[model samples]
Target: MSPERGRPPRRAVVRAARRGLGYMPGTLLIAAVAGVLGLSLGAGGVPDVVPAGGGLTVNDVTSKAFGQHAPGLPIGELRHFTIGNRLFNTNWVIAPASVRSLDGLGPYFNRVSCSACHVRDGRGRPPAGPEAPMMSMLVRLSVPGPDGTPAAHPIYGEQLSDRAVEGLAPEGRAAMTWEPLAPFVYADGSVVPLRRPRLDFVDMADGPLGPGAMTSARVANAVFGLGLLEAVSEAHVVARADPDDANGDGVSGRVNRVWDHDAQALALGRFGWKANQPTLRQQAAAAMAGDVGVTSEHFAGGNYTAAQTDAAALPNGADDEGVELSRKQLNRLTFYLQTLAVPARRDTHNPVVQRGEQLFGAAGCNACHTPVMQTGATAAHGVLVDQTFAPYTDLLLHDMGPGLADGRPDGLASGREWRTPALWGLGLQKRVSGHTFLLHDGRARNAQEAVLWHGGEARGARDRFARWPAEDRAALLAFLDSL
Candidate 1:
């Protein structure tokens, strides 16, 4: 809640908080301060037993954009380069042209190049350069379990993938049609339509999608500050789960746990809808398999049929199906993803942008799309704590309405759940090679359409947005672009 929301004034909230913590022993006081700010004093910085909220306020939170970086990781100098050269021309090796070709592109692949999906290791939009929306991206799907529970992944033949490594096995295609609702009119008269996608995946005639034939529609989300977000302690995440909606806010925030088959244990999901993958290593490696049809240590084999896996054209890595992923490649991709920095926030001075930020909080967007958070330490990445980050997402999945459901379950995430995407790095849209295709499934032509599609738990917030004035509406869009 904002400091101004309570009946009490700013000073009163601060004062009451101070008195409430007055009895905390010195050790607890020091720990409390460290938990929130995580900053050190000068060279001799020792724990200050001072009361919390000495002068913190909304404005005070304005400059808090620098989140903690994983300590040991190198902060490479991001010297600029052309989009093709920096993102497309080379492979994950960062060598001159190590991984440039599509040699292992698929037994059921979406695109030929990593850059094909992720425009500049940045954001990708709909109709990415006039490509069909389905080619723009494909999601995973599966059928329900015997007990009628949602299935995260296809238990049998793959859920959805169009291309193949050797033209040897079952491949599926995804098609989408839009149903537009009535236009939304602001008090000042700007209109926007609320559209949802009814996706159809077909042509998997070679086999049946197993246990649960569910689908997860995904497009490349902005990759920024992944390492820092990874380093956040599980304790901090559990601290926020409100699955039962005990607060009566109509929003039930749930945490999803995933099975890291590679790690061989259940892990708290930190990526994908329902937090399906536990860490960047797992997510990146699996992408090597699903997105590129390349076998990795984690995925071990291509998403090919038994016959396709035996095809001579299969890559060196897939000789033995279901083998382990390449640990070396996993590390490299994880390194690249983790090192990607969050773009600086833009447009803070515009009145509309400022109002949007205010409304974002007022409408409870911040509760899920939290403006900031800190990271903790990890041996692989040190000094992750104390630094501040502005991811604009809590990395938790929320219950979006049926309009957005893909009917694919993974781990703890139901078909209707999706992770809150981070809004940082959004302003660079115009710089990439493609058009501004926003929203999952590339359905919303732009940011405005994206906002209007909100429903389910977000219905209240979307309704509030629908009733907003034109200037206020513009403010919200401005705030979103500022990310």
Candidate 2:
């Protein structure tokens, strides 16, 4: 399919919103919530507080908020966490180096280490423009496959690696140019400028990205609270799959069934922008192979296409098991991700944030971004089991419409679908990663832009948000920041 095939027109979106397509009134939604929870939205009462990560929540608001380990962890566990942290930040060199473990750097890869992209364990931002290099972002490429699956491009493989090891040339560099979309206008006559990214592949090592190639550029997301998300039982997540929208809420969410290397079977995908990886361990291992070109047990062998002989023939710093990353090392890295703490919500008592909380429910943002979920008893770590947490997501896939579409499919997710990202620790994005770029490709510049870019199943909530008065919108954003 053409990249622009399914994209809805800007004017059509506005007219549909005006026509009340999937739009829910604020009063009716609030009344429904009040009826179900038996809770008052009255002026005198404050909603009870729920820990953002259950026992794993931290109380830091500073720059290090996203980097903290879960509090009250045992000393032995902390030791493993420290080692994993070191490995995550380690910069790998070329193969045959003195340090055997840290050697086997990419013949073709995006960054030097995990920290290079996910700076401080927080979100990553796209380059300022075509002039700047993509330091913290990467591009995915594929051609149409036989059975609706994505096949890796013959020369560049699944990902574009702009940087290569010393001797060989890099695959290619991706430059982004922003095309301005029509400014979104509120009911009160306020206008917000919006832009979408246009990607161009330049300075190719082998050859051009031939015809029929589909590409999707994505910025790295935050790495915290993933273990908690993984612990949410598959049954619990599957129960929320209203694929047919049987309730007639105009919102249908379903799970992505993806390959699990460990289990050797299809499992619920709960990580990545499209929910493509089933577990944090597989997610980490895939990142090692794709982003850093380090081989692991989960993904063995060099990250090279058969066409790139030099890259494929490089000497690897593989251990006895024939992979650059050992099983023990992978275990430590997975443990690090599994035990990272989620930052607690701040400024809950502020009246603006409080008002925003009510508007959030009124706008039906809580339907997909479910405020609460409970982890089951099967987590490997005791701290992650049977805990109620407020991560602000249902861990399900939803069709976000063509406005935010990449026209790239993965696993069971279509071009129009994306996993609802957790909104926890959103406000501190700038302090931690130095920018507020949101969405899969960093197209949305802030939380408000992120909301306005919503469509498909979220059109109702997005339109309801746009129709609100300025004060109500501010309160809703303030409530989001509080998370």
Candidate 3:
């Protein structure tokens, strides 16, 4: 049974109220008790808190929280998961290095390893300033092309690699200048500042980017619970698409149909900010080629474009198996990503969190950040199949308005469209990644800012959120924090 259906227990309510009003004096506690008894404690009364990931949720809520494997993964597979973990954290060096298994860092690439961007399997943050090196983020580049596909930059290709091997000139350095917009005032008289990012390229090996080049700034997202998401039936995801807002909810979510190299056919995209990759394995392969300049079966050659003559001359790792990463190695990395567990929600029973939960639905945040979903039987792993989870995302693309648009179309996703990111381990980002940046490009500094930046399909929810009273806002935030 769903926890929200029943009346909350008295002890749970009192505990939640105590936690919610922890800063308040003793008198406030008396008042809170009275309020609870009067049935006016929360927005619509105390709500029941469900387990965020149902059976798959882990209990840890610390710096290492995002690194756990899903509970009950078979012991035999656990060994494979460990092998995959090593591959995930392995730092690749330049070709002809002492470490043959980890060689082939880059002829031209952004980082040397997967962990460089997705630090600790958590989210990546934007650079602190224009002078700061991009440690955990990257810039995607493209130009207008024939058909639906966005064309890769002729010189820089699809991504700009700011770093390269010993002899090659890096593509260019990427920096950002932020232009602050006027502050927006909420109905409750709170002011929130917003900023837009403008990307700049300097020291280009191929001179300036094409005049028509379109760019998108992307931050690495948390890598947990992806297996469960991948496990969701394609039919289930497609069924959620309401591209025309047929229900009149003012929210239209659609799926991105992308090419699956493995299948050699068009398939539903389930990963990336624009939902551009159809499978986790494919996503890993693309990252290997694009970010680390390490080739896999999917991308057998180096990441160099034909124009990157200097980069093409660099030595690359090759074996009878085909590319830099063996199929075994790629399988291990995919397994690692697939088994990383979702952290269990914290403070779900807190009165403020409970109230916020009610307000979250009331404000229509649940429209795209759908709270519950059931995994189907098609999961690659038995552990991920037939599980009901609370990932808090519909995993469909929604038009996020001009404020968040990258002005770069990806697959079926428009410039203004972004896939609804899962919010399961959101509150733990600061602990895991050492920062609180949110959203695709890491522009929003916190959850509040993230919500404030929402527009287009989410404008209604954002407006409703702004209209909420201070206490209600606190409750809503508390609820999000608990998640």
Which candidate wins on lDDT? 2
lDDT of 2 by residue, 1-483 (tens): 011123235464344333332345645654565543334466544455578888999998899999999887889999989999998999988888889988888888899899999999998899989989998999998988988688998888999999999889999899999999999988778888899999999999988999989899999999998889999999999998999999999899988999999999999999999899999999999999999999999889789999999987778889899999998899999999999999999888766665667667778898899888889988969889898888888888899999988888888889899999999989878778888899999998888889999999999999999888675676678777778
- Model 1 Cα lDDT, one tens digit per residue, 1-483: 111111334464344334434546534653543444333432323332211111111111121222112224334412211221233323332112333332344556666556566655655554323225454466666566577765434332434667654545536566666667788676767666666566565565446454335566677765546766787788878787788889988777788898777679887898754577888878876776777666666676556545443443444433233332345445655656655445455555544454455556555676677666666555234334445566666777788898777656677877788777766655545444244556667676667776677777778888887775554555567667766
* Per-residue C-alpha lDDT of model 3 across residues 311-355, encoded as one tens digit per residue: 788788766676889999999889888888888888775655666
Candidates in order, TM-scores: namely: 0.74, 0.92, 0.90
Where does model 1 exceed 4 Å of error?
1-104, 127-133, 147-159, 166-170, 187-189, 202-212, 305-315, 318-325
Go through the candidates in order and give the clash count of each: 33, 1, 0
Most accurate candidate by TM-score: 2
Lowest lDDT 10-mer window, candidate 3? Answer: 33-42
Q: What is the model-wide C-alpha lDDT for candidate 2?
A: 0.86
Error of 3 at 366 (Å): 0.7
Residue pairs clashing in model 2 are 356-475
Give the higher-TM-score candidate: 1 or 3.
Answer: 3
